[model samples]
Structure formats: structure tokens, C-alpha cells
Target chain A: MARTQGSHSDITGPRIREAALALFARHGYAAVSMRQIAAEVGVQAGALYNYTPDKQSLLFRLMYEHMQDLIAAYADQDQTEDAAEALRQFVGFHIRFHLQRPDEVFIAYMELRNLSSDNFAQIEALRRTYENALEAILRKGQAAGAFDIADTKIATLAVIAMLNGVMTWYRAGGRLSLDEVEQAYWDMVHRSVTA
Target chain B: MARTQGSHSDITGPRIREAALALFARHGYAAVSMRQIAAEVGVQAGALYNYTPDKQSLLFRLMYEHMQDLIAAYADQDQTEDAAEALRQFVGFHIRFHLQRPDEVFIAYMELRNLSSDNFAQIEALRRTYENALEAILRKGQAAGAFDIADTKIATLAVIAMLNGVMTWYRAGGRLSLDEVEQAYWDMVHRSVTA
Candidate 1:
């Protein structure tokens, strides 16, 4: 019975998160409720408590896992010592990774105000960890004389912000193919950072 | 008496907008109500209706006015035919204008999903007008061989997205003065568009 219950939790965990993310993305986090999430997941409110203590925990987990997954996915990519090549890879990777997770990306930016102080700090730390990955590349490139950057930290944020813009208006069947879109941005990012 | 009531509306209209903007920024539009806005404005719920028909109308009016103010302010700036100089002015103007109204900027992006479809279309048209202003600069620069851009529209969006990033993390008296910060971004923007 214990094993069966554990298995159930393992399955229900992702479903709860999926439901919470969708609802939070559609209706702002403040407007979504525990019961609503449970309803979306086809579970009772009590059963949701079994999975997460409350809605905030669920939100934190979704955001935390999104960041964790992002870091891990990027880490799994091949690393190169050449700073320009690495930065190029980053431009492509950042755009592609974020484009695939629209709801998570939306919540990550939109719901930061709703996080508890502690939760916000933890998420911010994770975000910094992800951002540092890019900042380090900018610093390495600057040290190696491959890129001309005013401030590595600002460049890092600017690059990410510019890439994140893709999610706002990009549609698969839009005027430009995804490859064309990515190439255009990569060219601009490359020029922006390099002499 | 009629003139006095008209003056009262002129004063209360702005107060109502101020209260609604603050409330919607703090709480999502879906979660905030006419009654809440009325309380925030220190008026009765029924009195709120006199100022605005409903919560949705208030939201549309706030968003409408923000876009209108943005376009009007940008239009009032010194016009220059030089593409690089014009682009620099834009980078500075976009950052400074948005930084002053954090609430409006936050709501502009975050609350788009909350706008009624008709309201959304009008706001989007206003936004496109603003974007076209930038795109035209890029096109002129490219035509004159002043800028090396892969796609003028894409470059327009990329530059604006990059500049909009300042609103996310800028604070006065931080490591960089506002001038330094703007210079850094302007350098990046200028480089990205020009050879």
C-alpha cells in the first residue's frame, strides 16, 4: 500500500504542477485558488494538500523546477572554450529553450510579485545561477578579447531580455520560420557584443 | 453649479485613474473589482461607476492613456534625420520614459491578457505605431548604408526589447548613474545596428 501510494504521488505531482502552471498563466496567480487548481487536476482540494501544502508552494515548485530544468538542459549542451562560439551557442540555446516553455516563462516574469520573501529569494538565487552562466561567457569573451561589452552583467540581462521577446510574438507559422528568426537575433547579438 | 460639477469630475477623474492603476498593478485585473478600486479611491462603489462605467472600462482607459502618452511624448522629442543619432535618442527615451512609470510599464505588459479583445486591438495598434517609428529608422539607416541589419522589423523589435529591459532592474544611485547606464545600452544598440 505504501509503494502504491508513493507511485500515485509520483504521477499526481506533475499533473498538479501542470494544472497550476496553466491556471496561473491564464488567470494571474492572485486570482487562482487551490480548489481551482485541484479542480483542473481532477482531484479534491484535500488531495491537493497531499501533494502541495498550498498554492504558494505549488507556484514556487513550478518556478523552481522550471529554472532547474533550464540550468540542467543548458549544462547538458557541449561547452566550448572559445568565448564567441559559446556566446553564439547561448543565443540559440536561450531562445529555443525559452520558446518551448511559454507558460513557465510567462509566470517566471509575471508572478515574481506574488512570491513570499523566502521563496522569492530562493528563486532569485536560482535565476542568478542561470544568468551567471551567460555573464561568465561575456566575462570570458572580454578577457580573451573576443567581445566588446560595456558591462558584462548588463549585457547578460539585455541579451536575455531581447531573446525573451521572441516568445511574445513568435508563432510557428508566422512570416518567418523559427530558424530565420533565431539567425536574425543571433546576428544582432553577435554584432552587439563583438567589435 | 454645472461648472463646479464639471471641475469636480476633472479632479476626480485623475484621482480615480491613479487609484485604479495602483490597485491593478498590485493585484491582477481579474482579481480586482470596482468596489476595491472605489475603496482605494476613497469613494463609494456607486460613485466609482460615475467616474468609469466598470472595472474593464477603467483598465482599458489606463492602458489606452499609457500608450497615448508614450506616443505623444516620443513625438514631442527633438526630431533628427540622422539614423544613429535618432536611434540613440530612442534608446534613452524608451528607458527613461518607462523607468518613471513602473506601474504603467508593469501593467502594460502583464495585463495585456486581461484586456477585452476590442481594447487589446486598440492598444496593439498603438504599440505597432510606436514600433513602426523605430522600424522606419532602421529602414532608413539600412537604405542609406548607415546600418547593417538583417531585417529591419526584427532589428526594431530586438532593440526595443533590449531597452525595455532597464525597467526590470534599474534603480537610481546603483552602481551606474542613469547616464552611464543609458550610454552602455546606447553603445550596444548603436553597435548592433551599425557597422
Candidate 2:
């Protein structure tokens, strides 16, 4: 649909992004049309173009923003030099942060294949940067002999993937509380490196 | 296109499945259509239906077979009674098995949301049964004081998650061989629970 005059006057940037995120997360980037996203946002398809150039941009933006938000949240958390404490904090922080945004987490992992090569590389870089935060901790622990990890990079990937696993099955009123889940994960994570 | 009489003789059941798996993995379950799958398989759209009822059935069959194959392979592997040894065997088996079938593994985790409720339940049951195999090892280890874990169930998930992470970044010609990758993961998996 072509945009009528001032058709998008009522729409905000975040509202469009939110709609795009939910739709892409549900139907996937390749499957979802711009019109569907526009319908979800209650905007004309032409009006949607004002916020994002195309579906590719929307997918990249969502993934980039998710990674940036993750990096920012980790930065805002109580980061410490104590390797064990920092690792422990990362466990709780990662689980809580990811649990709150299941859709974003899902797309971040699932929709990588649909992004253009440049976009994929961009997302991977952001992911690596986020990963480096944890890898740095492992390196510190390895340096201090506090943690005995075979490969810091591989271990970093392993731990992040493990934490992400919580989002798949952990429900709010399930048998385990969020605190217990975090504590349980922290115990496994802490032991895995320390042992 | 609708099938013409005698137009379906060339296509086989395995060919239909192979096409469906590739399409679904590339474009996601919600995005790929039966027509598209038929195109991939060089068959008429109606001819595709003669093998599988619908897109949902195709998705379910792919995931079901993957899980069944995983369980069967694990059973075929040297399944020992010693908890520590069983866990070690699990880490190696999971990494190798999942690495070889990246597309199936990707769809199995990513496409679950697209399944009907009943289909979802069936797949979840299979997944839980698979997870239980590892959990049983953790439980035995816990009982025998071989593994010092707080919760066997969570440990099972965490360990599996940790191992599954390999499929995301691991490449064959990269710095590490499959042996090294499995070894690195096994080391972390062993320490994560044992420590």
C-alpha cells in the first residue's frame, strides 16, 4: 500500500521496530512480508519504509540492536575483576537478561542464515564482542590459575550456549524459580571451569 | 503445479524428505511452502502430498527422525554403565552426531515453534527422552559420588547445551580438529560437572 499524506504521523520508531521484531521472530525474516509487518504496526506498507528501508535492514537492525543491548546491559551490570565473582555474575546476568527477551534470543540464534553476508558478519562481530566479555574473564582466570579451561574461546562459546539453553525450557511457573535456575546454572558453570 | 498422471513416478519418498529438509533448513518451516518443496524435489505439488500430508507433517518427520537417529546412534555407541564414562561417551557422541547433521539439528531446535500443539508435544517428548539419557548418567554419577552436582536434571541440560554449542562455530578445517573440539568440550563438560 502506498502511503497517504501523513499516514505515519501516529507511528513512533520504537513501535515499528517492536512490531518488526515480533513478526520476524514468529514467521522469520524470509517468510514475513513488509505488508504483514505494516499490518502488525498498524501502518501503511509505504509508511513502514520510512522507518526501515527493507526487510533486510529490519532484520539486521533487530539483531544488531539485540547484541548492542546485550553488550550495554552487561556493561551496566556489576562487572568485577574477580574472575570467579565476575563469572558468577555473568551467569546470573546472562540468564536474567536473555530470559526477559525470549523472542530476541530466539531470532538472534535462529535467523542468522537469512541475513546478507555483510549483515551476518556485522552480527557475528557484535556477537564476538559480547562473547569476548566472557572470554576475557576466562583468560583472567586462566592467567591467575583460578580456572582451568582448555580453550578460552571454546569455553566462552560453550558457557554462553549453556546459559541460552535456559530460555528454551525454563517457564515462569515451572518447577524451578528464576533464582534457582540461575543458581543451578552458576553452580555448573563455576564448577566446569574451576574443576 | 498439480500432478499429471504418471508425473510422480520419478520422485521417491527419500527425495521428498531430502528436499524438504534442505528447504526448511534454508528458509525456515513457516517460510517454505509445499510447492517450493516440490520444486526442489522436481515433482508436482500434488505429487509431493502423496508422500507427506502437509508442511507440518514434513517438519515433524524431520525432527522425529533426527531425534530417533540420535537415540539410536547413542544406543549403538559404546554405552557403558559407569556414570563418568557414560557422560564422557555422551559428550563425544553428541558433538559428532550433531556436527554431521547441522541442518537437522538447526531445524529441530528452531522449527519447534511452528509445529501444531499436538505435534509439538510429541517432539518435546522425544527430546525429553533424549535428554533423559544424559540425565540418567548424571543421576548415576550423583548417586555414586562420581559427579558432584547440585541437580542432575539441570546439569544434564547444561552439559548438553554446552556440547551443542560446538555446531554453531566449529568448522572442519579450523584450528581444531573434530577430535580436538570434542576433547575441548569434553574437558569442560567433565570439569563443569565434576568440579
Winning candidate number (TM-score) = 1
Candidate 2 residue runs with Cα over 4 Å from true position: A1-11, B1-11
* Candidate 1 lDDT over residue span A114-137, tens digit each: 899999999999999999999999
Interface RMSD of each: 1.4, 1.7
Docking class of 1: medium
In candidate 2, what are the lDDT values of residues A58-168, reduced to their tens digit?
Answer: 888889999999999999986788899999999998999998998898889889988899999999999889888899999999999999888888889989999988987
- The TM-scores that each candidate's chain B achieves against the reference are 0.93, 0.93
> What is the alpha-carbon lDDT for the whole of candidate 2?
0.85
The residue pairs that clash in candidate 1, if any, are none
Q: TM-score of model 2's chain A, to 2 decimals?
A: 0.92
Residue-level lDDT tens digits of model 1 in B124-173: 99999999999998998899899999889888888989998998899988
Residue pairs with colliding backbones in model 2 are A192-B192
Per-candidate DockQ vs. reference: 0.62, 0.64
